[model samples]
Target: MVDADQTFVIVGGGLAGAKAAEALRAEGFTGRVILICDERDHPYARPALSKGYLLGKEERESVFVHEPAWYARNDIELHLGQTVVAIDRAAKSVRYGDDGTVVHYDKLLLATGAEPRRLDIPGTGLAGVHHLRRLAHAERLKGMLTALGRDNGHLVIAGAGWIGLEVAAAAREYGAEVTVVEPAESPLHGVLGPELGNVYAELHREHGVRFHFGARLTEIVGQDGMVLAARTDDGEEHPAHDVLAAIGAAPRTSLAEAAGLEIADRAHGGGIAVDERLRTSDPDIHAAGDVASFPHALFGTRLRVEHWANALNGGPAAARAMLGKEVLYDRVPYFFSDQYDVGMEYSGWAPPGSYDQVVLRGDAGKRQFIAFWLKEGRVLAGMNVNVWDVTGPIQDLIRRGTPVDTEALADPRVPLGELAGRD
Candidate 1:
């Protein structure tokens, strides 16, 4: 048990850090807690930045998790615009940027999250090329979108992942001609598999969004410090006024390594390794959210999830463990994305090449359906596009490791709840 006045220092004031701090206080700990964030603003939801927030449909004040006054009331110190440079485990303190202030902590939570990856191709440093990872990036992109009016400019997205596709939908909604360049055969092929990827390709194409699959980009070309076009490996050029690189993000783990903590092998790029209790190799320190690469019960191997759900759900789990509440973080992974008018929801674990049977429910032609992935006889995961009700039953089946009848799942006449023996 920790002393009443023991300090808890949390790095990276994004969703994970913010939620962890709140959870610690809610758990009845009156200990001193400090949250360090590089950004000036308090914690705000990021998922809306690509959708409602970027489109100007949602106000910034509405997206903030809590007002600045709330932090004051809770006695949680907010270190805005402060960057933690290194962690000295031996001294039990962290070094921040030029402030000469070393924060001492009895327990430390590293939620230092991830940043969007950038392409190293030529002309990447051009004025019109940008990566959407933070609120500042979204604000800049929103301004650029306003400058380029309807049917006047073209926006080229570098990747076909969720971020790139969501941005593509938003750009299209703003009346800009949009094109997505993907090196794979289909969008989200790496994650959703080819069948679901085809559905996404069809959905985007139906909305007049152009996709160049199996095309490898070689370099970005610019003139007068502004992006102009992207050249492919096949000697083909595509014109663009603005370029958004939504390839993916990498974990911010430099401080953990600098502190001489054991780093885990990279599952999805290079993320920090942690146990089921969210404890790092150093027992005094814990890692959560996008930075922590954790072992999945379904996959039988460590994996790193980039969804907002992971950050929100996993952060508190780590905090509880630090407070001596022993529990394994085994919640089924889930995420949602809003693209155009479609809302896609996914749950459970789907390891690559682990599924033998795939059951499709509802009508994809009508733009509403759910796809269930089964390994052997048990349900492993399910992806629902514009179908929200299917998530609950699928999640239950995944949790119980229940064997679903493929025939019942594929038939729209039968309710999904009946297949899992829930109803």
Candidate 2:
């Protein structure tokens, strides 16, 4: 147990940081806990900001993780609108902003998370071009959707990732002409592989969303201060009223790097290196959520997963570790996305070049199916479209590393929960 007066300083008040603070209180470590957030509002959930919240299906107030009174009742001091500038490891304190107000901490949890990567192409700074990352970004895009009057304006999504597809669905729901530009052969090609990605490509196409596969955007052009069109490398130009860049995100690790922590070099981007326990190079300083590159047990390599599940799970795991509890975080990674009236859920690890077999249960055309990715004879990962019930059993089988009959897996009559008994 930590000392009653021990100070725990948590940076970034996103889901990860907020959950960590809540978890600490729930776990009965009632020391002085301070949550430092650059945003003025209380901690809010971000997942719905891209879908339900953007579409007006969910209220903005409902997105809050906790009410203000909840924090006060828990004795969790919130330092909202406070930016942590740097960490003084030697002094065991963190400096905030230009004023350099130092906050001492016995243990520090870095959940700085990530920011949306911006396109460097010309006309990217146009008024109609935007990137969806924060609540404010979504609010601005939602306002643009209102001003554009759905059917009259065109929405051009520059990336085919989850966020882009989500926004595409939202825009389409509002009767906007939507087109998604992806340089890959299929949407989500990098994550779901070509075969499964084709399923998404077909789904989007059926919903009247145009796809420009294998097309690289050369530049975004604008008329006056507003975005107008986008030109591709193949010399093809598409008229666009609004441009959404969803290429992906980069870890927000500048503060940690400035604090003299060793940053991990990632092929896709940079992140903080941490052990299985989520402890950084400095034991006192732990990192979790999107900013940390964690070791994946199934893939047998370090990976950085930017998802709501990762942030929620990793945050609490790091908090427990900071409290001197030894726990190895090796749960199967899971993520979900909603688009065009379909809910897509995925679980487990998909290592490149490892999967040799993919068994499909149910028909993809019907938009209700479970695709199990198998490597050798064991389940590596599984993706479900409009089938969340099957994910629970598939995730269990993946975690257990169980082998199943490929024929049985393909049979829709066979309950997926029974697969574990087959082993």
lDDT of each: 0.85, 0.86
RMSD of each: 1.4, 1.6
Highest lDDT model number: 2
Question: Candidate 2: where is the Cα deviation over 4 Å?
Answer: none
Candidate 1 per-residue lDDT over residues 90-190, each given as its tens digit = 88898886666898998999999999888878888899998998888989988878766554798888899989888888887777778899998899877
The list of candidate 1 runs beyond 4 A from truth reads none
Give the C-alpha lDDT of model 1: 0.85
Q: What is the TM-score of each candidate against the true structure?
A: 0.97, 0.96
Determine the C-alpha RMSD for candidate 1 after optimal superposition of all C-alphas.
1.4
